[model samples]
Target chain A: MTATTTVLISDRPIDPDRLAADFRKQTAGSGAIAAFVGQTRAEAGAVKALALEHYAGFTEDAIAAIVDEAVSRWPLHAVSIAHRIGRMAPGDPIVFVAAAADHRRAAFEAVDFLMDYLKSEAPFWKQEVSDAGSRWIEPTDRDRQDIRRWRSAPHSGEQ
Target chain B: MTTRILFFGQLRETAGRAETAVDLPPSVATRSALIDWLAKDDPALHAALNQDSVRLCIDKKVVLAEATFSAPNEIAFLPPFSGG
Candidate 1:
């Protein structure tokens, strides 16, 4: 099967619907599709905007490797990820992940893994532009905890 | 031998510059040594580099402080990521 594996980083907005349609077209035989969109929140009016910075050539490579690892451990028919850079307002979409597989379980698991990997491991930094003045932010402790779920079982189940 | 060191986010703010091309002295060979050498004059940068939260990337891939490469390579230092 000719499946598409896309990992994209853009300074422009990402279209989740368009990406979903493209993945569906590429993984024609897949019966299940799972998608996740990460949006910026207002943080109780603390944040006016969020500026994201990436290590250029490295950000894509790091994300691609994470995608490769996911495909290697899952029976995925297609996988697509998009991360937006630059300034984004609250309630704006910041990231998207989509995966397709023959079964719902595989698609769900792959998308879950993809999100954790992107949040913790990808080489992108974020700064909150606020009335308190801008400050760079780090992954929350919860993010680190979420990522740990995949460590002990990197390849526990596969088809 | 020279290498281009890049800084991002908070680290960039601390360094007050985006990139610095440094000519490596013979005494400064490894990543660890390079930091110590660069930190000689700048206390803020020294503190920042010595911070456990500092992360490094060589030629765009995350690597350990022990990782080594030839001159003219690109190296980046960044703080903890907050990407979603």
Candidate 2:
């Protein structure tokens, strides 16, 4: 198989359709395609506004590693991820991840896996400013609980 | 020797700078040692580094809290990432 492309971007205001097109162009098989777009919400609870920050060089490298891990762990033809940085207003686009694979299962699983890893593994930080004042948002135990699910495989009864 | 230590998000805001040079004690050979040394110098970083919720990376690679560090390296302390 030829070498596929992996797009990892960190910028202000992410474009979901552009991310989808990137994945589509990278895959030749065109059997199945899956995409996930995560946008900023009006209410994240306790968060009046979120300011995301990352190390200039280190952020990109950390994200690239996550993308590489996704490519290795799954049979994906193409994968792309984009995230926004700086002071972001509510309801703005935050992140995008799209993958194309030979089957829907692979595509879906790959996207899910990438999202999980990105949430817990990537090196980005957000500070929530609100009526309570700006505080560095820390990942709650629930976030870890969600991450733990990926470590174990649930039987699908494929027999 | 000095190493470029980076801080992100709240840590940067608390420290009031994105990156700064921290003096390394002579026997500080690992990443873990560097954190210990830094905490001794900067109270804000000391508290942030000691928090279980925080993480560290060296030259863009996540390393264990006790990982070794070399001279002229890039180090960063950041809260957990939730990009997706």
True contacts kept of each: 0.88, 0.75
The sequence of per-residue lDDT tens digits that candidate 2 reaches over residues A24-128 is 766766688888887666564655677777667776777777667667766777777777777777777778878777778877877787777777666678777
Query: Model 1 over residues B20-41: C-alpha lDDT tens digits?
Result: 9988776666677778888788
Q: Each candidate's interface RMSD, rounded to one decimal?
A: 1.0, 1.7
Q: What is the TM-score of chain B in candidate 2?
A: 0.76
- Least accurate 10 contiguous residues by lDDT in model 2 chain B: B30-39
Model 1, TM vs. native: 0.92
Candidate 1, A6: how far from true, in Å? 0.5
Worst 10 residues of 1 chain A by lDDT: A150-159
Which digits, one per residue and each the tens of the lDDT, describe model 1 over residues A65-101? 8888888888888899999999999988999899998
What are the per-residue Cα lDDT tens digits for candidate 2 across B1-84?
Answer: 667888787777777888888776668776556667766777877777667767777777777876766665677787767655
Off by over 4 Å in 1: A1-3, A155-159, B68-72
